[model samples]
Target: MKIISPCRVHMGLIDMNGSVGRIDGGIGATLDYPNCEIVGKESNEIEIEFSSSISNKTAEEDLKALYNRMYTSANNILNKIGQTGISLKLKEVIPAHTGLGSGTQVSLSTGKLTSSIYGYNLDAYSIAQLTGRGGTSGIGVSGFEYGGFIVDGGHTFGRNAEKIDYKPSSASKNVKTAPLLFRHNFDWDVVLTIPKIPVEEQVADKKEVDIFKKFCPVPEIDVNRFCRLVLMKMMPAIIENNMKSFGECINEIQGLGFKGAEVQLQKSTLKNLLIHLQNISYSGLSSFGPTIYSLGDKKEIIEYSNEFFDREGLEGDIIISKGNNTGYKLI
Candidate 1:
């Protein structure tokens, strides 16, 4: 069995105030390019192979730890379904820690492949829970399950609730999944500006957790504005396929607390690039980003990025991708 999972661009967190008892509301859309494709078969023991080299930018120990985590998660899931062993070949993978939701896409792909090959009928939601994902935001899982523009209602908040603190998925202990609040098939092309920054400069693990802890419980008014933007502007634009309105709304999202914090922590070069793009297009940072996504004419965005790189004497990967309206599939 083989599974191809689309990657997602996280827009921003809608609310973390927990004032109304829920937190981590998020918005995102799936992209057709930069996907994780896995092929697997039954075997005597757990094994995984990669089609191409894992990113040279990632450290060896970090790569080993990532593979181990995925293997262990898949092993546990397969064991629960009475399957003994499996061999997986990673036909393709998204870049890790680049704010493209690589971990969830890879994990969900592995879980789905294991379940399907062994005759288990596990939905993506169950697979997410079993694989221990979707704790922070449902957008990734929802994109894997239903693809397109997605909004998650997030988790309930309190001292003993499913989630109380703002943390990365790796540190989340809750077994609960964020609920999908809204979805729509988005028909627009996204130009991704992926900067190849040094691993040390990138934010992940402890630094990510610290950022969430320090900046969360953002002011209530900012949360309210995020809510208003999504409910009144973003959703309507998506539903009506109003590209201009959608872009306008997206341009304003980074001002919200969650992505706002990420922006503040980003490297100066990335910060400048984001500002430059904003002058000519609607662009926003993705996750804890060095990746900025712009929605507009594909050719114009590409030409603009190329010009920017030349003018600034900088280099990075630029990709043009369309929205993935359909979820993952078996091939």
Candidate 2:
């Protein structure tokens, strides 16, 4: 069996303040490129192989981490289903820690393939629970199950709530994936620019945890404004296919609530690049990004991003992708 899972761009986290008794709501869309593809077959013991092509683009440390994640997820699923093992081959993978939600896609793909090999079919949410994903944002898990523009309702907050503290997905294990509030097929063009930065410089694991601690519980006012934008502007634009309004909302989101904090935390160069893109077109940082995305004017944005990279002497990849209306495919 083979499973291909699409990558996602997490627009932002909503309601970090949690004053309204819910927190960690998120908005994001699934991308058609930079996906995770894995094939699996029954085996007496677990085995994993990576395509040689993957080495040219993915860093050595990232490959190791991917291997470990696949192995651990496969093992966990196998134990859950009372199965022994499976041989898996990774044909393609999303780049790790680039704010593309690679970790969740990889884990869910691994667990799903392992479960299928044993004739145990499970949904993304179930696999997410088994694999300890969907803790902080439901966007990744929801993207895996239902593609396109998505808004998750988030978890309950306050004392004895589903989540009491502000945390990223990695640190919030055992939390159920949030409920899906809305989903629409997004037809706008998406341009992704991933800046190649050192692993230490990128936020992940402990660094992500620390960042959350430093800037969380953002002001309630920003949270309220962010929610209004999403409800009144963003959602309506998607439904009506109003590119201008959608782009405007995307631009505004960068400076509101937890997302604003995330954008403020970017390194000077990346932060400046985000500003540069925003000036030319609508753009926002995807999660704790080195991957910044812009909506509309694909040609102009790609050309400008190349120019910016050249001017800065930076190394990275620029991709043109569209929303995937369908989630993962099984073949």
Candidate 3:
């Protein structure tokens, strides 16, 4: 069985960590874009073969840890339940360390497919919980379960709520991750530009989150101000096909996210490349590091990017991606 999970770019992030007793913010939207693919092939012994293009960028120990974790997690989940020994080979395409959630995608897909192949009958939510790959925010898990244009409820997941686990639970039994509420409502098209640069995640970990709680323990406001930027500004604009709102928000969020996560950002040729694009784009920094997503009309984006490249000599691989509605799925 094989599973492929697409990646996403967050438009605007709001610090909703106040509710969860943490400091991580809530994201406005997750645009479907580049995705990571994983394949699970059952084998006789307890052996797993992992091959991924992003492995070139993944730290050796981390890579081993990821594989070991998945293998052990899967074995524990399935074998203990049914004694089914399964083998997996991870086939990856999405670039890693670019803030594309490559690791989460791979892990989510692997878990989903493994469950399906063994006929364990695990639902999508259960699949996400079983993997522990999308904790950065439930949106990734939500995206894994659903697809395009979604807002995973915050504060709930961060509260150590058993309901949010990928595995099935009583609290979240009938939850569907897809856009069932608005099946044909939203069309999201995003252009993903990945410059071969290192990017790191910029968020407070568990420990840091604790420190944040200590420093800033305030009441939870409606966050309407921030949501205004997303819903009143970006959402309506997207529905109406407005470019200005999209660009403004996109550019602004990128810059803010960059400033928030500079220390862990891996080195890349992005800043220099951005110069060529600046004149023509509302580009901003993407998750963790080196992937910059530019939001604009399809024509304008192409036009400006080409103009910048030709006129200013910018070089890097660019992927023109349409907003993905398919979040995570098994094939």
Candidate 4:
């Protein structure tokens, strides 16, 4: 069995304050490029091989922890089903720690392949829970389940809520997957620019937790406006295929609370690049990003980006990918 999973670009965190009755509201979509592909079949024991198509990259030591996490998740699922033998090969991987939901995609892909090789019927959400994902934002999980433009209704507030801390999904464990409030087939071509930057600048783990601790409990007013932009503007624009309105909402999102703070935390170069790109096309930072994505005319955006990169003497990977309407597939 082989599973191919879509990569996602997290537009931004919509709401962090549970004041509106939910803790996290997020928006993102799955991309057709830079996907993770896993091929596996029954074996005497679990054996795994991993590689990537991005620049002919191999899984580095940095990915070891993630690899182990996926293995453990798959093992747990296999144990539940009384099956334990498989040989897994990761043919391609979305670049990790770039806010493209690499971990979730890999883990879910592992779980699905393992389950299928063992003759077990499993859904992606269950695969997510078993793999310890979808804690705060369901964007990644939703992207895995049914690819498209997605908005997740976050966890409910109060003491008994499963989410006690504001942290990234990697640090979050044992939380219910957020509900999918909206999904629409998005047909825009997204241009993704991933700048090469030092590892220290990429927000994750402790730094991510600190950012949340200091900046979270985002003001309700900002949250409300964000909701309005997503609900009243973005969703409608997506349905109507109005790129202008959709692009406008994408530009305005950074001014909102959590997204605003995230932008504030970005390095000066990245911050400038975001502004520069948004001027010509609809652009936003993808999750703790060094990856800035723009959605609009593919040809125009790519041409503009090529000119801008040369003009600014900047170097990065630029990929043009379409939004995925159907989720992960087994081939």
**Which has the greatest TM-score?**
2
Candidate 1 at 184: error in angstroms? Answer: 0.4
lDDT of 3 by residue, 1-331 (tens): 6777777664433443345543333353345446666677665655666675657666786677667766765765675356566777766646555666665566666667777776666755666566554443455666666666654443334345422322211123333332122211236555566644322333324433443334333224434445456556666666777777766765544444213333223334456554445556676655544666765565776666565456555554667776656666667
Question: Model 2 clash pairs?
Answer: none
What C-alpha lDDT does candidate 4 achieve relative to the native structure? 0.84
CA error at residue 229 for candidate 3, angstroms: 0.9
What C-alpha lDDT do the candidate models reach, one value each?
0.85, 0.91, 0.54, 0.84
Instruction: Report the C-alpha displacement of residue 156, candidate 1, in angstroms.
Output: 0.7
- Positional deviation of 316 in candidate 4, in angstroms? 1.4
Error of 4 at 114 (Å): 0.7
By lDDT, the best candidate is 2
Model 2 compared with the native: what TM-score? 0.98
Q: Cα RMSD to native, each candidate? A: 1.5, 1.0, 6.3, 1.7
Ranking by lDDT: 2, 1, 4, 3
Q: What is candidate 2's lDDT per residue for 1-331, written digit by digit as tens?
A: 9999999999999988887899999999999998999998999999999988886777788889999999999999999999888999999998888999999999999999899878888999999999999998999999999889999999999899898888889999789999999999977779999989887788888988998888889999998899899999999999999988988988998999889988888889999999999988899999999899898688989999999999999999999988888889889
What lDDT does candidate 1 reach at residue 237? 90
The count of residue-pair clashes in candidate 4 stands at: 0
TM-score of 3: 0.70
